[model samples]
Target: MPSDTLNQFLNDNLNELKEQGLYNEIDVVEGANGPRIQIDGRDLVNLSSNNYLGLATDERLKEVAKDAVDSHGVGAGAVRTINGTLDLHVQLENKIAEFKGTEAAIAYQSGFNCNMAAISAVMDKNDAILSDALNHASIIDGCRLSKAKIIPFEHSDMDDLRQKAKEAKESGQYNKIMIITDGVFSMDGDVAKLPEIVEIAKEFDLITYVDDAHGSGVLGKGAGTVKHFGLQNEIDFQMGTLSKAIGVVGGYVAGKQNLIDWLKVRSRPFLFSTSLTPADVSATTKAIDLLMESTELQDRMWENGDYLKKGLKELGFDIGNSETPITPCIIGDEKTTQQFSKRLNEEGVYAKSIVFPTVPKGTGRVRNMPTAAHTKEMLDEALTIYEKVGKEMNII
Candidate 1:
């Protein structure tokens, strides 16, 4: 049997989370995650997915992935350094470099692993990192893993960042300093002030890293946030994921050739973990090709996002300031937020509640992600459901 102390700790914490409505009860999706999904034998409008471009179910990518499976088999048999690096992997990395307008790029198994590998590989105990307070959990974990002096600045506050950067540089206690931020904050959908951040980094001689996981294929005509601000040449690291915008399952870091070379040899995940499978690599390459071919999907996504935001705003619900397609309906109370999401699900909408630890306490919300695949009819139906639920609960 497991230790009683461990069992007690688990029981106590689980009970506390359940009582406060903080315990997440994950619902199983019956099919591909798209604009609509099935759960418990019922179909619901899905506004909780990160499939912004709707390419996850694209026929072109599917066909390519199938071809890759036939040609290259199911898996990359070994770690990248130990021969798992196939021709498909090289092709994907090249395509990523082309898409990101970087000298070179390296792919990873996941966005979280990319952060974990990249940050710790470069920065160390002797270094300092000026991180945004609202950065993702992955970025926080990465910084912690680096064992760097992490000084968090206020979110999007350039002055705060400048002060922190100046202090870190002037302290002369660190061998190196890096400024890391999410190009687009996923929670509230606010874009980072990259231009200002770049200016500060330059003044302080700090390395710049932009995790554009949410911004890729959604901004800068699909090149990403660095290109969105025309800072491709200025930013040192342009990190992104193939999973979200590209509608595939991988992550990557795009930078100068030297940086890519270093990460190839030094990044733990790339060195020790198996490379991406043929299907994922090929599918991701196709997705990037589609993104670069035209901006039709990206444009439609913005239109749908604007339409949804306008509808939510007109209904008098406190949809927070979201610059992107991610819309958050603030409910204030944690249990109320969870209840609101449950009602949304019951009424055929599948948005999820995000509460404490994700966002600050007292700001619990139901995050609605309107993808490009959602037709106007779907949006209208979702809005109608929102209206009914909002009025019933007096949320409006």
Candidate 2:
């Protein structure tokens, strides 16, 4: 039996969340998460996935993954330091390094783990991190785990970042100072001012770190945000996920050989957690290869994004300022945004609403991720549904 104390505590919090309209009910997809997905036996156009290049379900990646599984086993039997670092893992890291234009790279179980590992590995109580206000939760947690003083600047405000960097550097109260940001802000689809950030880092002599999870397969012709600005060598840490654009599962930090060596030696996750499976490593390697070979998938993804944004704007939706393929239709009120997303799902489009806490209180939105896999017909259908629902709900 469960402890009464634990049950009561959980029940009370859950009841409060339900009353505030903050409780989330997850919808389960019935099959592979692709351009279209089935939920509750209804087919719906999926605009909520991070498969920017449509490589998650690509046949070539599938074949490689299957072959790896047949040749190797399902799991990496031990922690990486204890012999779980398979040849496939090494190959994946090498591929990541080459693709990112870095001297070397290190892989972790997931993008989330990469943050926890890398941040804590290098930073400590004597260090300070100047972080962007809108960085991901993983980055926040990682910074905390480092036990370093965290200084947050206004989102994408170069002036604010420079001011904070100056204060931290001149104070001389910390051994090291690092500036961290999301290469692409996920909520608004607006890109980070990397050029300005690099300039600031250079002036302050601060180490630069970018979490390029959303930018990896969508920016820099699919190389990433660092390469987008041709600052691959300037940035100290280039962290990204294999799960998002790569269409696999894992994360990595690409940088100088010294940084990679230090992470391998000190990162707790790499030392304690088992490495990624052979299949995941092989598939990720192949995905990077495809990305390097051509930019067709990224081009298609951008085309879909442009079409969606134009259609929504024509229908009187306030799409935010997004330079990337990530489209957020701002709906203002939280309840309205949730209702809008619900209507979209009911009408055959599957876009999830991002409400308060995830974003600001009144700036709720329905985030649409246009992938390369979506067809023009599918997007057109989605636009029609949006118009119908927007008019019916008085949103347009």
Tell me the tens digit of each residue's lDDT in model 2 across 63-141.
9999999998999889988888889888999999999999999999999999999999999999999999999999999
Output candidate 1 Cα RMSD. 0.6
Residue pairs that clash (backbone atoms under 3 angstroms), model 1: none
Candidate 1 global CA lDDT score = 0.94
Q: Could you tell me every candidate's TM-score relative to the true structure?
A: 0.99, 0.98
The whole-model lDDT of each prediction reads: 0.94, 0.94
TM-score of 1: 0.99
lDDT of 1 by residue, 1-396 (tens): 899999999999999999998999989999999999999999999999999999999999999999999999999999999889999999999999998899999999999998999999999999999999999999999999999999999999999999999899998999999999999999999999999998899899999999999999999999989999999899999999999989989999999999999999899999888888999999999999999999999999999999999999999989888999989999999999999999999999999999989999999999999999999999999999999999999999
Off by over 4 Å in 1: none
Error of 1 at 136 (Å): 0.2
